[model samples]
Target chain A: MHRIVAFFLKQYPFFLFLLLEIVAISLVINHNNYHKGVLRLGVSEVSGTTYEIWSHITGYFSLHQQNRALAEENARLRSQMPDAFKASDRKVFVRDDTVYQQQFEYVSARVVKSSVNRQRNILMIDKGVNQGIAQNMGVMGSDGIVGVVQSVSANYALVLPVINVGANIFARLKSNDQKGIVSWNGASYHYAQMKGIPGHILVEQGDTIITSGQSVFFPEGLCVGFVTDYVQSPGDNFYTIRLRLGVDFNSLNHVYVIRNLMADEQHNLLKENGDAE
Target chain B: MQNSPMLHIGRFAALGFTQILVLNNVQFGGYLNPYIYILFILLLPLRTPPLVMILSGFAMGMFIDLFTGMMGLHTAATLFVAFYRKRIMKVVIGVREEDYLGTPGIRDLGPWRFFYYAGAATLTHHLLVYMLEVFTFINFWSVMLRTLANSMVSVVFIMVAMVLFERRRHG
Candidate 1:
């Protein structure tokens, strides 16, 4: 007992360091499974509020650019409006609304805080549970698919972006519908690698990659990126295709969170089929 | 040079805010993130108790973590800087900490020695941070490159800040 006491007395600093490190590591490990507890609430709320205020102050700096982008998107959307099309004499028929029920809904949210330099990048947006935001919803910028919602607080939601090493976005070639998984290689924010493309298929530069409507997160044909280059190693069946992502994560501001209305129904049907098999 | 806790506390808040708000946002080539917050740990009084140093490091790291949502990464890395700080200081300064007066900075150790001191400390901190963040050795070269590049940027930033700080003190 005396020896132990003396040893501790001599090495208290090391012990203290070890103890604190363990606590920190445990916090990291448990942070993933964390529900909306008091500590998380407090931290998220404070950080969320601070980021909102800061973004508001900084938001003015880029008002002109943002307005231009918004105007361009508005122009593009306006061209798709039903009223924009003139009356046609050749058997024009209105599509029945009941035949095409809305499967996806979008909630517009302003990004409060975002980081792209890290291996695992997360963005915080102003809308949260109060605005009908939930886990696993897909997020998209004006240009392309952004990320998926990982967690949500009452007033904010955290988005796990495509640039993160942990995120995998299923994308396909716009020309031939060749499917592949787009994943970040922890190298650059401007690019990601598309894997699982067969070597036999010829991939060219400037080939557009869009989200494959397979996942419940993103809708079909949302722009993901463009193929910049690809290489097929000898004896390898897969081509390692490099792509330039459409969304510029560094200057990401406003985004739309996509909530699939039929997600639960599709998921339940899939699960039931799997269980039966 | 002031031994007051208030001085340290003020430095803590100032550096912490600078790191979280400004430095974290400043990224070059999407690879370099200059972490000047560790400057707080590096500039602590030489005679500060090891326990105080460790606790302060942990507190500062947690404070940054709360804002960034990276709970353990900063805490673990900054704790290492705190733990090895004295040894690095002793190596660079070639003197027992007890014999030294005032916080170590560009003014006290001159620009070159301060650079070496801050460089070693930030390198150690950034290496641990990037390694732990990647959590793999598969891309060891990229990790090393990031560490070296970011450490250089951070050390340069620290040197410039210390120079400005010394100028202010003198004026």
Candidate 2:
């Protein structure tokens, strides 16, 4: 026993390091299965309070740029709605009245904390659950999809921005109508990977990537980014296409949290179908 | 033993905050951000408890994981490096720590010895982090390449920081 103690005492730092790492790995393995406890309401309340304080401080510096971006986006949306009315674009494709567009209900929030330099970056939004922002809602700015809400507090929400490792969204090519998972490659905040795209489909640079709208988060046709590069794996059935997310996470602020009015119904329906299938 | 624990904790937290706030914000060449948390393993107290050291590393990794959202990649990498830190210490420093003050650095291990120890640990940590971050889901070639290149850059920074820190502490 004395010999054992002496040996361990000599290598204690080494042993301690291993012990900590084991615990962390255990958490990572269990994280994907962490559905029950994570969905509670308190996280959102904490988020709301923090967002309010941070936004109050950074709001001044970001106001002008945010306003200009909002104005431009509004102008663009207005032009598109009128165009959709005159042309048959809106009528032909959007007959599924189930889709609700309540962009007007968006609450703008500033970003006081963000991480783009790491392989997994998260954005801290100044508005949280108290601001009517809830988890799983889509977050966007003037350009396009920024992220989805991960957790929320009364005054703050933690946004897992597109640059994060776990940031996966269902996106489709506008011209080709192919959909797949869009994930970050941990590089080029300007670009990310879109996998599971059928290799047989035609791909072009500058092809627009838009939300598939199947996630019950972002509405369909919300601009995501453009395909910058694509390659077909040998002997594989899918193409790995790279997309540039529209929102620059580096300059995130004043994002609109999209609340789908029918999300609860849609979620329940999906759950029912999932069980049945 | 008492002062060593405090020393390690304070330095760990300080390094953790810097990596999260400042280093995470600095981006250059479109896709390169040096991993600074390797410093935690690179500077563990020489004669500290192995269990405590690993726990500190895991805590640091979890601290990083909470912020960046990589699920568990940082945790995996930090754990791996912490596991190997002793081998690195033995090979680089050629001595088991006896009465070393705080963590092992140039002040404690001298310039040449500190470089070898810090370099080996930092490189191993960066390579593991990149691999785990892109593991099982992403492409292999890209992750491997990024891991190698990134490890090189971060190792350079760790070397410089050790030299500077030692000079300031001793000189």
Q: CA lDDT of A171 in candidate 2?
A: 90
Task: Report per-candidate TM-score of chain A alone.
Answer: 0.93, 0.75
TM-score of chain A of 2: 0.75
Top-scoring candidate (lDDT): 1
| lDDT tens per residue, model 1, B1-171 | 376899889989999988878888898988888999899998887888999999999998898889998778789889888987988777776654434787777766677777888998998999988887877789899999999999989988888888777543455
Q: Backbone clashes per model, in order? A: 0, 34
Model 2 Cα shift for residue A72 (angstroms): 3.8
- The whole-model lDDT of each prediction reads 0.87, 0.72
TM-score of each: 0.95, 0.75
What DockQ class does candidate 2 belong to?
acceptable
Off by over 4 Å in 2: A1-19, A32-104, A117-120, A164-168, A175-187, A194-204, A229-240, A273-277, B1-10, B38-41, B49-55, B69-84, B96-103, B135-141, B167-171
Q: Write the per-residue lDDT of candidate 1 for residues A86-197, one digit (tens) a residue.
A: 7686477668889999999999999999998998777989998999999889999999999998888899988889998888888999999999999999889999999999
**Root-mean-square deviation of each candidate, in angstroms?**
2.3, 5.6
